[model samples]
Target: MQFKILQLVFLFAICSAANAATLNKQVRSLDWWQHASFYQIYPRSFKDSNNDGIGDLQGIIEKLDHFTDAVVDAVWLSPIFKSPQVDQGYDISDYRDVDPDYGTMDDLKELIQKAHAKKIKVILDFVPNHTSDKHQWFIDSVNGVEEYRDYYVWANAKVDDDGNRVPPNNWISNFKNSAWTWSEERQQYYLHQFAPAQPDLNYRNPKVVQAMKDVLTFWLDQGVDGFRVDAIPHLVENEELLDEPKSNIPGYNDTDYEYLDHIYTKDLPETFDMVYQWRQLLDDYTNKNGGDSRIFMTEAYSDINHTMLYYGSADGSQLGAHFTFNFYLITDININSTAQDIANTVNKWLDAIPEIYTSNWVLGNHDKHRVATRFGVANADGFNMLKSLLPGVAVTYNGEEIGQENGEVSYEEGQDPSARDPAIFDKVSRDFERTPYQWDDSTNAGFNTGAKPWLPVSEKYVETNLKKEKADPVSHFKVYKALAQLRANPTLISGDVTVKAVDEYTVLIKRSLNGSSLALVFNVGNDTATVDIAEDVSKSNKIVLTNVDSSRDTGSTVDPSNLKLEAHEALILSF
Candidate 1:
C-alpha cells in the first residue's frame, strides 16, 4: 500500500510541473498591449498647474504618479497641437507644436520623459483627416499658391437656373449645415465634412499624404509610443462628388447631420488604405529606431463590419491598426440591459475579430457619458471587471477609476462646439462628461489651484473624488487596482475564454489555462441572483476580487456550486 501511494504522488507532481510550463509559455507570447491597461486623459480637464482653468501637460506631470500606482501600461492624450479650439483641438493648425492653451513643446517633452521613467507608454491623438482653416497649408491653399492649391478638396460651384451658384453637391457637414463653404479668394468651394473651420485635407494629393507622413515621423522622433488616429473613416472620400442618399429619419431637421446617409463621405475603401499606409510607416519606424513597437489605433464610429475592416484587408496582406477602438461596451450595454444582451455584445466582437488581430475594450471617453452615470454608480465596478478581464487591452478614461459621474453644466455654461447651436444645446452638449477631474472636495474638485474649471465640477466630488475612494475600505479605486493587477496573470492574458449568460441577469466569464482558472460572475440586474458555477470552477475556490458594492469579501473561500450575488454585484474567483 505505501509503494502504491508514493507512485500516485509522483504522478501528480509531474502533472503540476507540466501545467506550470504551459502557463509560462502562454504569458511569454503576449505583446505589451495584449492584456495591458490603457488610461485616456482629456488634457483640458485632467488638471491645471497654473490655475489657468484648462489642464495642461505640466499638470499631467504633477499627477503622473497616479498612473504608476494604478498599474497602467499606457496613456492616450487627446489633441494638444496648436489649434483655434474650434472643435476643442480637433482642428489642428500645426501638427508639430503644442498649443499655448495646453503648454509649450518643452512641457510636453518633460511629460514624455517622466512618463517613460515610470515605464508608461505615451500615445498622442493624431488628427490627419482635416486641419484648422487657419493652418499655413490651408492659408496658402486659399491664396491659390501653385504648389498648395491642391492641399484641400476644392470644387467648382454648381450654377442653378437662376444663375445663383450653389454648393457643388448636397453633402452636409457633420456639424449640421452645408458641407461646402465657398472661398472668395480661391473662387471655388472647399469641402468641410466636419465644421466649416475644419476643412478636409486632400489625400488625393501625393504631396499631402507625404506631408502627413512627415508629421507622424516628427512625433515618432519625439518618442511617442504611438498615435490614436482620429476620424479615420473620414480620411478619404469618393473622388467623384455625389449627393448621399437621404436617411429619412423622422423628426430630424434636414440641416441635421443625421438627415442623410454618409455612404460617400465615410468608410471609403481608400480610407482603409490610408490607415494601412500609416501602419506601414509606424512599423518601418520601429525597424529603423530599434525600440518597442509603435502602434496605430484607428477610431471609426462605423458599423461592426466597417469597423473591423480598419484592422486590415481580408487577405491579411496589409495591416491597419494595432487594434481599432471597440465602443460596443459603451454603446450597446446600458443600465437596463440584460445579461443576454451583454453576452451577445461580447460575442459579436469576439466573432468578428480576425484571428491575427488583437482586441480592445473602451468603457467611456471624452465624448460619452461616464460609465458610473450611464449605467448607475452601483454597476461601475461590475463593468470595470468586464472590461479588465476580457482577454485584451482595457482602456479607462480619466475619472473612471474613482467612479466619477457627469457634472451638471447648464446650457449657458457649455463650451463644446457641438453645443453652440442653442436650439439643440441641451441634447448635444458633451460638457457634462468633459468636466474637470474631481481630485478632492476642495474648490473646483482640486483640479486646479483656484480658478474655476473650464466646465463645472460634479457636486458629488465630496464623496466621489479619488481621495475619498482611496480611503474607503471598499471602494471603486480598490476594486480597480485589484483588477488592474490581475491583468498580468498568465491565465487572464492568454487563457482560453468562455463567456455566457448564466441567467437572464447574470454573466459568467471564465479564463482558463492548464488546470488553473479565473472566473467572473456578475449580476447586472436589479434583483438578487443565485448562480451555480460548479461546472465552471476548478479546484481552488478563492474569491480574488469583488465589486465595491459587493457584500462578499476577497480572499474568502466559497462554493462555486451555489453562489449568491446582490444586485449590481460582481465577483472574480480563482480556481
Candidate 2:
C-alpha cells in the first residue's frame, strides 16, 4: 500500500525531528531565568484521574512521570481557564479555552506534549489581572454592549452632582469593597478589582488590547511555553487624580488589613505598558513559532526594588521577569537568617533592574503556608523551602519535596472559596495551603482511591511519599535533588558572587564561572564553629555537598589554620 504509506511518512518525519532536537536543546540549554527549577501545579488540588474530586488535564497527563525524577525543570500550571471557579482559575472565562473542569483543549495539548516529552516546560497561569463575571467580554460589556462596552473599568457619575450613582473614585478592592461594581446592566459603574465576581479588565481598551492579543495567540498557537502572570502589577489603574497615603494607624481598628496600600492602584506606570505589551506579544509568537521557548512571569505584590522596576518598563522595553512573592512573606530557617535573607533579596534585585533583568523565587505558592507550615515536622531543613534564593527562578510547591505540612480543614472541610471570604465570609478556613498531592502512601494519599479528597492529605504527608522518598537517604527528596544538582552547577548558573567570612560562625560563598572556582561553606551555629578559610581552604577539603551524610564529619575538621562548622552544615568546594 505504497510501502505502507511510505512507512507512515517516515515515522512522521522521525517524530518531527525528535521534537526539533528537543526544543533546540531547550534553547541552547536553559538559563533564561537562571537555571530554572520551577514546579508549581495547583490545578484544583492536583490529581484526580477520574475519581472525580477534580484535578484534571488528565491528571496532569498522568503525572508526567512524577516530574521525571524531580527537582524538576519547569511546569507552573494553575488556572486551567474557562472559570466560574470564581477566583480559582483566577476567574478567566476563557483565555483561549481549556476548563471542561480541567481537560480538553486537546487535554491541554496532551499536557503540553507530555511536558515537552519530559525535558519539561509548560508554564500557563495567566489571569491578566481579571475577568469572569462569567466573562463573555464581561457579559458583553455589562449589556450596554457598545462593541463589548469598552472592555471594563467603567464609571459614569464621577460624583453625579444630581443624577446620583457615585463610584469613580475612592478605589480600594484588594478584596474588601468599592472598586466599583454597581453594574445594573449598563447603569454605569463597573470595575471589580476582585470579588465582584472578578471584573476589572480595561487596560483603558484598544479593543481590550486586541482582545488580549487574541487570547495570547491561542496559547502560542497551542504550544504554551510561558506565562505565570495573575495580578501582574494590577493591570494599570491610577492614571493620576491622586489622594492616598494617610494612616500610620498604630492605634484603634488597625486591621482593615492596615488600610491597604496597593500604591495608588498597584505599581502603575501603565503597569509597565501592560507588561511591555505582553512582551511584544510573546515576542511575536515565538518568532513565528518553530521550536517554542517563552516565559513572561509576574505576580508582583511588590518589593525588591519595586520588583526590579517591572523589568524594562514600557519601551525601554520591560515586562516579563517577575518571580516575586518572596516565600509568601517569609518562612525562615536561619542559615545566618538564610544568608541575610537572600542578601537583602539580592540587593533589591540588583539595584532596581537593567542587567538584562529577570528574577523569580516563588517558594511555596498556592497562596502560602506549606513548607511544613512552620515546622510542624517534615524534612525539617528545606534548603529555604526548596528554593535556596540568590537571584531569581525557583518555584517548588507540590508537596514541597516530601515535607508537606498544613492540612486539617474544617468549615465543613472547605475547598477554597478563597478560604471563604465573600464579604467577610467568616465561615473560617484559611491556611492549609490548598492540599492534596501525596503521590502514594495509599488510601486517599495516593490522591484518590476515593473516600473523599478535594483537599486533605498532609498527614505530615504520610511518611513523605514519592515512594517513601525514593527510599530515603536523609531525604527531603534527596535534598531537593542535591539542591537542584548544585543549583544547576556549571559554576552554579552564571556565577559571580563573593560573600566571605571566616568568622562569626563561618560563611564563605565564592562562585566564579568560565574561569571555574566554587565555595559554599555555611554552618551558621549550634555547637561547633571555628573560622579562617581562604588560604585556598585546604586539608584536602573536597566534601562537595552535605546536608546530612556523605561522611567526613566536617572535612576532618577542615583547616586553613582552623576551620570548622557542624550544625546545619554545608560546604560545596570545587576549584
Candidate 3:
C-alpha cells in the first residue's frame, strides 16, 4: 500500500509539470479568438441612451465595463449601419455610415477605440447579401441607371396564357411572400430572398462585388476588428430562374415560407465562393496592415456539411472563415433532449469539421428564443457549461449569462417583421427574445430611463435581472464568469475534447492536455443521475465549477467512481 501511494504521488507530480509546459507552449501559438468568449449584443435591446426608447451605440459604449467585468474577450453588435428599420438593422441602406437611430460615425470610431482599450475586439454585422430598397444603389437600379441597372437581380416578368404578368420564378421570400417584386420604374421583377424591401445584391456583377469589398475596407479603415457576415448563404443564388420543389411538410401550405425546399434559393455553390472572396479580402487587409487577425464569423444556417465549408476548402488549403456560427446546440437540444441526443448533435459537428479549422458552439442568438425558455430554465446553465467547456469558441447572446427567459409579447405589441401577420404571431414572433435587457429591478429593467422601452421588458426582470443574480452566491451569471475565466486556462484552450453519453440522463465531456484532465458532467434529465466516469478522469476529483441549480459546491471532493448529479445539473471537475 505504501509503494502504491508513492507511485500515484510521483505520477501526479509528473502530470502537473507536463501540464505547465504544454500550457506555456500552446498559449503562445493560439490566435486571439481561438479560445475567446464572444458575446453578441443586439443594439436595439441592449440599452437605451438619450432616452429615445431605442438602444444606441452610446449605450453599448456605456456598458463596455459590463463586458470587461464578465471577462468577454470580444463582442459582435448586430447591424449598426444606416437603415430604414424595415428588418431592424439587417436592411442596410448605407454600409459606411452609422444609422442616426444608433449614433454618428464618430460614435462608432469612438466605440472601436474604447473597446480596444479594454482588450475587447469589436465585430460589426456585415450585411452583404442585400441592401434596403431605399438605398441609393437600389433606387438607381429601379430608375434604370446604366451602371446600377444590374446591381440587383432583375428579370423580366413571365407572361401567362391569360396575359397576366407573373413573377419570374416560384421562389419564395423568407418573409412568406413571392421572392420577386415588380419594379414600376424599370418594369422588371427584382429578387428579394428576404423581405421585398430588402433586395438581394447581384454578386455576379463584378462591380457590386468590388463595391461590397470597398465597404469592408471602409470599416477596416475605421479600426473595426472584424465582421459577422449576416445571411451569408443568401449572398448568391441559382441564376437560372428555376422553381423550387415543394417541402411537403405536414401542417404547412404554399403561403408558408417552409412550404418550399429552398434548394435553388439557399446554399448554392456560388455562395461558398462569395464567402471565400470576402475571406480573401479580410486576410489581404490583415496582411497589408499590421494588426491582430481580422476574422469573419459567417452566419450560414445550413446543414453541417455546407456549414463546415465556410471554414474553408475540405483539403484545408484555402482559408474561408475563422469560424462559422454553429447552431446545432441551439436548434437541436431542447426540453426533451437526452444526453445521447446532445452527444450526437455535438459529435456531428466535431466529426465533420476539418482537422485544421477550429470549432464553435452557439446556444442562442437574437433571432432564436432564449436558452432558458427553449431548453427549460432548469437546463440553461447545464447547456451553457457544455458550450463553454467544448474545445473551441463559445458565443453568448446578451442576458443568457443570467438565464433570462423570453418575455411575453402580444401580437399587437410585436415589432418583428416575421411576426407581423397576427394569425401566426405567436408561432413566429421573435419579439419575445428581443425584449429589453433586464439590468436591474428598476423601471424598464434599467435598460432605459425613457417613458417606455422600444420593446416590453420581461416582467420577471425584478427577480431575474442581473443585479439580483450578481448578489447571489450561486447564480447562472457566476457560473458563466467562472467558465469565461476557465477559457483562458491552457488545458481548456489547447486540450483535446472527448465527449460521451454516460447514460440517457448524463453526458460526460473530458478535456485533456498533456497529462492534466478536466471533466464536465451534465445531468440533463429530470432525476438524480449517478454516474461513474472513473475511466474518463482519474487524475483529480475536485469539483471546480457547478451549475447554478446544482446542489454540489465548488472545491468539494468527489469520487469519480460514483458521482451524483441533480436533475439539470452540470459540474466541472478538475483531475
Candidate 4:
C-alpha cells in the first residue's frame, strides 16, 4: 500500500508538470523544439582552429553559422566533458569541467550564448549511465570507502543456479565482454557494463541517483536547454546478476547476440522511476525562468514500442520525448516491406504515446555510418526527405544535409568499440558513421588545416561542402532547410499523423492539426509510380514542397487513378 501510494503521488506530480510542459514556451524566436530542427555535431570533427588538428569548442563557436547553412534551430554537441576519451568522450572523468582538448568552461559559455543569439539552443550529451575510471568518484571508491563503494555495483561473484558456471552470471556487456571486471585495487569485480574503463553507476543506491541528479542540475543550472541521456536503460542492472539466456530475440543485433540471459538484469521496473526523477529535475529546471523544463529525450536501449512509456511522466504524467529513428537499425531498403516496417514502427508510438511535449526522431548520429552510406545512395536526398517529413521533432546528424557518405578510417582512426571487433560486428559498417564532417573542398574538407585529421574527411567533400551546395539551390541542404523551417507551421509539428500507402510503391501521410492538413507522398521506388488521390484533397490546395519530382501540378493528372511519383523520392503537400 505504501509503494502504491508513493507511486500515485509521484504520478500526480509528473502529470501536473507535464501539463505545464504544454505551456508552449518560446525561446527568443524559437518554439520548444516544435519550430526547431536539431543538428548533431561530433565536436571533434566539426571544425578546428589554431591548426591543433582537433576540433575544439572554440572551433564549434567559430563555425556556429555553418549549421545556419542548413537552417537548423538547435545544435547538439557530443560529449566534450573531461574524459579519458576511451569511448570518444562518452566516459566522463569529471562532470563540471570541460576537457582541455575540447576547450574551456568559458569557451562553452560563449558557445551557448552565441548559439542563443543565433536563435539556436544548445543541448549537450549527458552520460549518466557510467563514468570514466579516472573520475574522482570511481578512484575514491577503489580505496574501499564504503561511502563511494555502494555508489557502483561490486560483486564477489554471481551465485549461479548451477555449480559450474564460469562467469557466475551470463549478463554480457553491450560492448561484448564480461559485464564485471576485476579491480585489483578493490579486490572485487566491479560492473563495467561497457568497457573496463567505463564503470556503471548503481542507481539502486539513493546516493547514486542523487549524484546523477546533481550532474543534470549542474548542466541545467549552466543554462543548457536539454540533454541527450546516453545509454539510459543500462543504469541499473539486476542486483541478482542475471543475463539473457539467449532465447528468441535473434538478428536484432550482434551486440547482444552472445549467450547471456538478460532476464534478471536490464530493463528493470525501477529504471522508469529513475527516468521520472530525471524528468522531474528537468521539469523543475525548465520552469526555472518561468519556461518549460529542458527536454529529457533519452537513448535508452528500449526498442520502438517500449520507448513510448518513457515519454510518460513518472506519475502517469507525460515524460519528455523518447524517439530515436536511427538509419543504422533499418539500413535495408525494400519498397514494400521496408515501407511497412517504417510505418508500423513509427505509427505504433505515435498512436500509443500521449501528446507529450516532445517526440523522438533522428537521421544519423556518431555511432552509425552516414545516412547516405547506410541507404546505399551516393546522395541520400530521398531518405532524408522520408525521415524529416515524419510528424515529430526531427534531428539531422552532421554532414547529413549534404548527403555525406562515410569516410574511411584506418585501424588507428576508428574510436568506437564496434569498429574494434570488426569480425564480430556485422558491418554494413558502423565506422563510416564516425568519419570527420565534410564541410568544404578545402585541404581537409574544411574541417581542419592539419594533415592528420582525427578521422579523414570524406573525399566527396569536394562536391559535398556547404560552399558549393549553397550555390546549387537544389542541394539536399536547401531541401532540409525548407522541411525544417516548416516545423513551425503548426500542422507539421503538432498534427495528427495518418500514414497510409498511396500505392504499392508509395507511402503517403497526413499531418493534421485542427482541420488544416498536410499530406506527404513518398515514392520509394525506381520507376515513376502514379498515385491517384481519391481523398478530400482537391486541386485548389497549394502544394507546399516536393522532393522526388519537383513539379507539384495538382491540376494535372493527379486524380485518384493517376497520381504519380518518381523513384526514391518524397513529396510533402500542405493545405
Candidate 5:
C-alpha cells in the first residue's frame, strides 16, 4: 500500500510542473506587440499618386502591397495634420484635419479601412507640444481673444536699467535663437522651443488639456489603432521662466541651444504626470471599445532611469507609455563597439524596464542618419539580426531593408528650416536621410513620374533598389524578410533573452521558452572568427538561417564543436 501511495504522489507532482509551464506560456502570448513588427512611413516621401511631386494618402494606398509583402504588422506615419510646411509636417496648423498637401479627410479614412482589411494597423503621429502660429487658437491668443487669451505661453518683456527691453528669460530655441519671440501685436513675448512659427501650448490651463484630449478622441473615433506621441519630454516646462545653466559638455554643433544644460526648459516632472493622464484616457477608450488595447508610445530620449519612468511604476498599476523609444542602441552602439560592450548596453536597457511593460528597439528614423550609412553595408545584416532577435518590438524605417544610404542635398536644395540657417547649414541638415524611397532603377527611381521629387533620389538607386534586390536571392532585403518572418514563432517573440560575449568580435544571443530554444551568433567585425559551441549546441541543432554564403550548406548537420563565422556574418540555430 505504501509503494502505491508514493507512486501516485510522484505522478501528481509531475503533472503540476507541466501545467505551470503551460500557464506561463499562455500569459506571454497575450501581448499583442510581442508578435508584431512596425514599419515607419514618411508619407511625403513614400509615393506621389496625384502627380503633384509630393506623396499623399492616395500614394500610400497604391503601395499597400509593399507592406503586405514584407509582412509588417503595422504602419506608423509621420504627422499628416494640416500644416504650413514650416518644419515639414511637425508644425501643425489644424489638429483635426488632414493636410491638403497630403490629402483630404476622406482619403485618410479610406486608407485606414483598406489597411484594416489587410490586417494591418495604422498609427498616427500626435504632436501635443506646440502648434503653428497660423492655428486659430494661437491667432486668437495673440489677438487677445477673451476665451483663448491664455491658450499659449505669453509673458511681458523685461526692461533693464539701460532702458532696453529684452525677452522674458534667457531661454534659447532648439533651432538656435531666443525661445521667447517678441509679439508686436500683444506687446508681450511668446515661447517657442522650435521655430517661431510653432508656438508652445500652455498645459497649465485645464481648458488646453481638455482640448487636446478631444483631438485624440476625434481620431480615435476614426479608428486609428494608436499614436506615437512626438517630443513627449517637451510637453511641459517649468512654470517660472528661468535662465538655463551653461553645460560643461561641449555643444554637438555650432547651435547655441546645445551650449546650455536645458535644465529649466525640458524634461520636467510635470511631463510624466501629463503622460499618466494620457494613458488613462487611452485605457478608458480601449475598455469601452472592446478590442485589442490601444498602444501609446512616447519619444522620450533621456537617460535610462527617466525613460523607464515613462512606463509608470514598477508594480504596473499606474502605466503611462506602452513603450519609450530606446535611443541608446543607436547612440551607444557603433562599429568599434565590442561584443561585451553591446551585451552590457542591451542588458542594461532590458533590466531597467519592468516585466509588465514591453520594450522597443529603433535602428533608424526620419530624424537621424540611416543605419546603413552609419554602419557599413557589410555590417547591415548583422545589425538587422541583432534588432529583430531582441526580445521586443523592432521599428524599421522605410527603405532600410534594402540598405539605402543617405542622399546628398546641397544647401540650396535643403528644406529643413534649421538646416537652412547660415550658421548651421551643413551641420544640421536632415534632408539627406529623408529622401524619397527607391522602388526601381528607372527615371525618378520610380517614386513619381511627374515634376521632380520633393527631394532628390539617391544616386545609387540604379544598383540598389527593390527590383534589383528582389531579383537577387542573397540580398539584404531577403535577409530582412526572413528575420521578420521569424517573429511568428512564439519562442522568438516571448522568450527570455540572454546575451553571451564569445569574444571581442563575436556575440551570442540565446532565447528560450518552455523547452524549446534558439541561438543567434553575430560577427560584428571586419575579420573572420570561430567560436566553439560544443556545450551550447549539439548535433540535434540545425542552422535555420545564415547570412554567410559558405554556411548556407543545406541538408548538412552543423558541427557543434567548431562553429565558423565570416566577417559581418550572422547565423540562427534552433535546438
Candidate 6:
C-alpha cells in the first residue's frame, strides 16, 4: 500500500509538469498582439543622427537593438509625416512622405525593413481628422477650385443682431478658441477642431473617405503593420451645426474650452461608421496579403461603455477598432487609490469589453504625465507589474521603463501651442511630458551632438538612464524587461483575471488558464501589509517573481500562509 501511494504521487507530479509545459507553449502560440508588448516612440524626442538636435528615422534605426533587448514586439511611432510643425507633426502637410526634419521616405522604408528583420512590427500614427492648411487639397479648396471645394468643412459666416460677423456655431476648439476660422480668400469660415492650421476634413464627402483609404493602402503596401488612429471621437461632428450646451460645472483647470459641454462637436455617431469602413479596408488588405489581420487601435478617451462602442456592436457584425486604449488605469489609479478602487476599475473595463475582443492598457504617453511622477517611484513598480500581468496588450511609453520623471519646461522653453497660448498655458501644457529621452549620463543625455535638444532632458539622467539601469540587477528597467518576457506565458496572456481586495491597501489577482494558476499580490499603499494564502498555494512552494528584491525564484518553495509585503511591493506566485 505504501509503495502504491508513492507511485501515484510521483505520477501526479509528472502530470503537473507536463501540463505546465503545455500551457506555456500554448501562450507562445497566441496571436502577435495578444501576448505582444508595445513600446511607443515619440520620434522627435527619441534619437538624433543628423546633429540637428532633432531625432530622425536613422536615429530610430540605430536603436532597433534596444527594442529587441527589451523584448518589445512592436514600436508605435508618433506622426513623422511631412508637416509645417505648427502643431508639431499633428498638422500634416502630406501623409505619404516623411517630415524633412525627421528624414526621407527611403529612411522610413529602411526602418520598417530593419524592424521586421528583428521580429518587431511597426505602427505609425494616422491623423485622419485634419490636415495642414498648406496641404495641396486645402490650398486648392481655398483657391476656389471646384474639385477640392468640399474637401474641408467650409461654412458661410452669419451677421449677428449687432451687425458683427460671427461663427456658424458656438463650438469651441480644443485649443480654446472658436472652431471656425475665417478665411478671407474663400469668403467663408472653415472648421478647425485643433489649431487653425489643422483644417478638419469633411467626412461627408465620399471622395474624402476614398482619399484617406488610399493613404492607408499606401502605408500598408510599405509593410507597415498597423496604425494608431488619432482622436477617433472627433472624426465627425453633428451635421445640424448646433451650439454646444453650456456646462454648469467649472472648466478643467480653468481652461475656457471646458466651459461648455462638447455634445455637438465630438463623439458623434457618424464616427463609428467611419471607423467601420476603415476596419473593413484593413481586413481586405489582410486578405489580399495573406498576412495577419492589420491592427486598428483608436484614441477614444471616454467612459467604459462609450469607449467599448469602438470595438463593435453586440453581435460583432460591424467591427471597428481592434483595441480602444484603456486609460482608466492611468487617469484613475494613483498612489492614494485603494486596492479595491484599482480592482473595481480594472474589472469594470474587463466586463465592458466583449469576450471576443482583446483588452489594452496604457500607463503613460506623450500626452499625459509620466507614470513615475504621477504614481511615485515605489508605487510605479507595483502598477507596472499589474499592467504587464493583465490580460491583453500593454503599451509602455519611451523612457518609462527606467522610471523617467516628467521634465521641467519654463514658459520660455515651452514648444506646444497650448503652452504658448496665454488663455490655456497655465491649465494645459504637455511640454513637460514630451521631453527628450535620456539615453546615458553624458552631456545632453547623449541624445544629440549638435545644439541643445528641442526639449530639455530629464534632470535625473545621471542615475535614471538605460545604461545605469541595464547594469543594476534590481532596477525598474530590468523589472519591466522581465515582466515583458514573462507575458509570453499563456496563463497571463489568455487567462481570465479574478480580483479580490485583501485590504484597502493590498489587492490579490489570480490568473488561471487550463488548470494552471498564478497569483499576483500588490501592496499599493505606503505601509506594509499582510494577507492569508490558500493551503494549496502555501504548500505549492511557488514564488515566481517579487518586486521587493527583484528576484525570479523558480526552484525555491515557501510557506505563504502569512504572506507579508512591504509598501509598494508585488509578488507573483504560481500554484
Residue 147 of model 4: what lDDT?
86
Off by over 4 Å in 1: 1-19, 538-540
**Positional deviation of 152 in candidate 5, in angstroms?**
1.0
lDDT of 5 by residue, 1-575 (tens): 11222232343334235445663545365557655788999998899887777888999999998889888989999999999999989999999999999999999999999999998999999999999999999999999998899999999999988999988888888888788899999999999998999899999999999999999999999999889999888888778887778776764533478777888877788888889999999899999998877887899778888898888978987888888888877888887888898888888888888888787888888888888887777778777878888888888999888888888878778898777665666677888889999989877787888578888888989988988887775677877887787666656666788887887888888877776666788888889988887676666775566662434532235676787788887777776
lDDT of each: 0.87, 0.64, 0.86, 0.68, 0.82, 0.82
Top model number, TM-score = 3
lDDT of 6 at 498: 88
Write one digit per residue (lDDT tens) for candidate 4, span 445-464: 87787657776776677877
| Model 3 error, position 240 (Å) | 1.6
Backbone clashes in each candidate structure, one number apiece? Answer: 0, 5, 1, 22, 0, 0
Candidate 3, 62-135: lDDT as tens digits: 99999998999899999999999989988889988999989999898889999999999999999988999999
Writing each residue's lDDT as its tens digit, candidate 2 over 159-268 gives 57687767766666665546677877678777666678888887777888777878777777787787878777778777553545644666423224236555677788
**Cα deviation in Å at residue 527, candidate 3?**
1.7
> Candidate 2, 261: how far from true, in Å?
30
The candidate with the higher TM-score, 3 or 6, is 3
Q: At residue 281, give the lDDT of candidate 2.
A: 78
Top candidate (lDDT): 1
**Which portions of model 4 miss their true places by more than 4 Å?**
1-31, 158-166, 249-258, 288-292, 313-315, 318-337, 422-429, 513-516, 548-560
Q: Estimate, for each residue in 1-575, the C-alpha lDDT of model 1 and write its tens digit.
A: 11222232343344345577667766647677766788999999999999989999999999999998888999999999999998889999999999999999999999999999999999999999899999999999999888999999999999999999999988888788899999999999999988889999999999999999999999999999999999888888889998899999887777888899999999998888888999999999999989899997888788999999999976679899999999998888888889999999998999999878888999999988899989999899989999888978999999999999999888888988867878888778888889999998888889997898878888888888988877766678877886787776767777888889998899988988877777889999999988888888854676777776666656567777787889988888777
Q: Which clashing pairs does model 1 show?
A: none
lDDT tens digits, residues 135-184, model 6? 99999999989989999999989899999999998888888778899999
CA shift of 89, model 3, Å = 0.9
